[model samples]
Target: MRGSFRRYTRWFIAWASLVALGGWLLPPLVNVERYRRRLKSELEQELGRPVDFGAVSVRLLPRPGFSIQNAAIGEAPGFGDEPFARIERIECDVRWRSLWQSRLSFDRLRLEHASFNLVRRPEGGWNLASLIGREAPARGGTAAGSPPADAGGPLRLESEGARLDFKIGADKKPFAVINVAARLDLDFTRGNVNFRLAGEPIRTDMSLPTPGRVELEGEWTPGEKLSGPLAATLRTEGALLYDWIPLLTGRNPDLYGVLDLQADLRGSIYSFQFEGRGTLRQLHRSELPPPADAMPATLYARGQFDARERGRVVVESADASFRDSILHSSGNVEQVFSAPQMDLVVAVEHSRLEDFFQLARRFASGAGAAGLSGRLDGLVTVRGPWREPRLGGFFKAQQPRFIAGGTTFPMSDLDLRVNETGIRLAPVRVMVAPRVELVAEAVFRPPAPPTMRSKQISAPSPPSAGEPHAFGLRGLQYDLALSAKAVPVSDLVRFSRSLGIRAAREVDAQGIATASFGLTGKVWPITPPAWHGQAELRGTRLFLPGLTEPLHLPHARLEISENRIVVDPVTAVIGTSVFTGRLEHQGGRSVPWTFNAHTSQLSLEQSALWFDVLGHRPPLPLLARIPGIRSLLEQRTAASSLFAGLNASGRFSVATLTYPSVTLTNVVASAAVSGRTVQLGVESFRAGGGRGAGDIRVDLTAS
Candidate 1:
């Protein structure tokens, strides 16, 4: 038995050596180049294009394969003379048994350094349509009820360094892909194909960004018509997304970031569904200044598309997060007509407003958003079949606080709602101090037609035609009401200053002031705003800087309008004196004012309010250094348009008056001021039953 085994081993070794030698030496003896023209003709017929090559080599052993070097496939008509496809090298292997049967059945194909240009012609037909055959029934149809054609055996395909170019007419498309390495297993007998592809994204225009990697895997049926019930997954990562945005969206976007994305889908050409997730890290914008704080964000989505129905897309679910804050949404859009129809719903809960600001700070112009801290909850719904979308929603903030210019306002429980006609805020309350509260409510409507334009129409008319009143806020027209409860004067003054109301910041006051105000107007400052309001200030005990005793105003009624303010019958008590006045101010480029005041009884030493406006000093000069006094001095010195630029006139009557060492009865005075000059007349005065009158004038052009 040993001798027989040794003899068999020697025979096997000799046969293997002979086969190896034949595989290496047969190609040179056979003149394989002679068959190149024939092979090229066959390929041209199959590909529907002219084919050319540099060299062709045949291998007899090792499973019977051939190598073609430097092959090119010509383009279709009107697509220029450049080759549509080119390959540095290609190898194909066939089964030995197939060769024995005199059949040319390929088992495997490999391509290296291959490039293919896929183009869509100007008339909207693809260049490769001929190779794909007609989608309609063939001319010589098979008999009805005949068995299906037999699909060929499996073919393994491998490609390395492959590139695909997309073109419209003669111009390269914006986006392309290169450096593709792929592996495909096609089972024709089973009508199934499985493939893995990976590549780098490229831009046809060299100026565009080319900084991303993509990978994909899929399984599908490859029938004569290539109908699909396919499944696929894709992944991509990019370091600078803005560079590539123009290629995809044709817009120069301002965003910059590192982004990673992944998606999975299962469907067909007629209908499809997909889910995707993405992360954006180190995100910022080139146009915005660097943020003091920034955070990464994540987004998730799932959707379906139906090509049979106008290619509508329905987003079944979507979730996005900034830090711990999250927003969930769903929507559908269909372009079935010239105008699209859409419906969407968005809900946000447990979202941290501070974290959201961190993401929004780049777009906030480096203003007040960074100083906000709170949580938000909201629900929004939008529906549209007509031109204007209808919107309904509400957003509420809990324990929100914002700091600006070194002052903090704790705004609490703000609810903003949108209805059919306008946006509404029921009431938003803020704590101005330890025991002070400010509450406000508003309803903002859509913009109204210009009065002058609307006046030309005789009858009441609808809004201008062809101008759509779309959803969201267009131009803000609002009605507002505000009230304060037990607010301290000092705290209120500070709060008013923060709101750009500097006039109230310099008054020295004590105790609490209760106030109410209302306004109706458009919000844009460039347009004249309508104003209608009545504000009442009831001071428990208000003090002036140069006064020894505090004053009390029991009633002060003010009426406000777009161009005027009127204060009538104001009554105040200072020491034992009583005073009343009516003051009217007209708003214009130059303010014009009139005052008619009467005093039933007055004590000169107790009326500090009158003396305070003159930059007067109290008995103690140190009082001038107080906050209210200093602020008043600063404001007075800073004002370039004071009484000098004002047009004002006033008349006063006093029943009885007491000065430092004199007493007067039934005194009357009148004053006029215009453009840096003042004129005063003492109409009548009675002292110890004697009567007297005088007039005075002063020019104040310099000071």
Candidate 2:
């Protein structure tokens, strides 16, 4: 048994030695330069396309091969002036047995830093059609790894650091799959081509911020159009929503979310079916940090894509969820590579109310998402062109409390509707204060954003990839109307302060007011709100700077506009007496308000008291620091030396005037008030029904 084993081992060694001698010595013995011409010819004949290469050098360590620099394969007819594949360097291994036959052949071809261009013609033809399955031409040549004559090589190709560019007709696209390493085995014996590829996708238009790797491995039969059966996997990691949306909208809004997806494709290349799932996190519309208690969103899809008919995609199943809130959609999308249009219906049901859904927050911002606590049930229909899509839907939330500026406003429900014209929310009710209920409604119209020609456009339902958020954040314009019951003026001020109004926080007053006002404005820095409506005042009182007594106001109609306030039929009440007049306030630094009041049957002594209350003034703040100056500057006409800064004009009638020196009956006087000075024009006076008429000007000042 030992001798039999020894004999077999010796025979094996002898056979290996002979094989080594044939493979090692013959290729070096032949002039390596002559093999370069043979290689060019073989590749041209096999591929049926022109081949070009620069210089060539031999490699004999560990393997025998040649290194060719600047190699390129010519494009098919009518494609472009550029080559189909351009390589920085090419390396191929020599078949030793073929060299022994006094001819050269390559068993393996490796390419470095190569770039491949794949073009699709308008007529639905591909540039790679001529090369996908061109059978070896009828020529006398050595098959790969064989010891025969004639120029030939195998169909095994490996490449590193390569890029695949896509083009429509002669125009190249800015998107590419780059830094790719691939291996392809074209096994004619098995009538199939097996390929494995790994690469990173790059989008130059918006400079994709967070990119990820994509890999594919599949086998195809050449004669069957390389689609006898195919399977591929697509994966995306760390993708940002802003990067994809800002390219078209020209605005980088406040979303800082990340999306990760993994998908698998199966079937022929022309008609492939796919399924994918992804996770979305950190959905926020402002620079403020995302809510700490917010949960990430998830998405899934299963669909079949047809490359024919301008690229059709029919979704079999699509689902999205944010915790307990879920949505399901399915439909078809056509013209994917051009002006895509989708007819998909997304039905959503939000079961959890606390801490709003991230998916909902992505579409609705500011007041729309504020204190959205209730269960939501709705359906959204996505349809029409990609750029000018019409979203038709109705969403309602219940059992919620709206909060703004650290105040929780009690609200029972919210309803929103979207149609082709715009987004609208009608009749939203909330309890602003204990007994005052506020009813508000608003609407916003979004202008159609321009499209990026022939670029990938994604519809935003659950915030997949689009600029719908831009129209909300930067270009939004809404008309808001608010109607309220009799709200206490203090509560109104406090509520306004809670909403971040500086003017409301600084105001001090006591009154009850009810208003029905409407305003229109753009939600941008360029425009301020324009308010127009009417308000009613009751039980109102205000202490003026020039008067010590609080000016008790009478019921009046307030007409309000952008820059002015008008109080018509102004009134004042004193113990068992009432006076009527008019008041106007122009929003300006000069004399913000002016008022005039008059009363008949007033006693001269009582009328003197009314004049004192109406014409009082306070001194300058700094001058008031002096003891005597304060009392002198802040006094009625009986004490003040400086002019009182106030103005009013009216006519009064007196029943009787009593003084220690004299008693005058039936006194009529006209007064012009100007800056703490009373210009009195006594038209006439009577002492016992005997009338005397006179026009006399008198200055009423304690000089």
All candidates: TM-score: 0.57, 0.66
TM-score of 1: 0.57
1-703 per-residue lDDT for model 1 (tens digits): 9999999999999999998998898877888776677666545533457888887889876678788899887997877777888999978786566565533556777889999888877655566544332222233563221211221456677889999888888888767788999888766446567889998887765576566778999997634434457788989886467766665555554676778899998886457898999987767666666565546679899999785677587989999887789989999978642356878898999988777666655543424322667888999887785345776799888888865556778887778887556667777777777767888878666566566332121112223434444543325566667777567767777676665553454345555566566555653221234555555656545544434445677767777765788888677777687678988998685776899888887776556434433434433243543434554455454343444456889998999888889888998999888986889898999999899888989876765
Global local distance difference test of model 1: 0.69
Angstrom error at residue 362, model 2: 6.5
What lDDT does candidate 1 reach at residue 285?
Answer: 67
- The model with the greatest lDDT is 1
Alpha carbon lDDT of residue 314, candidate 1? Answer: 94
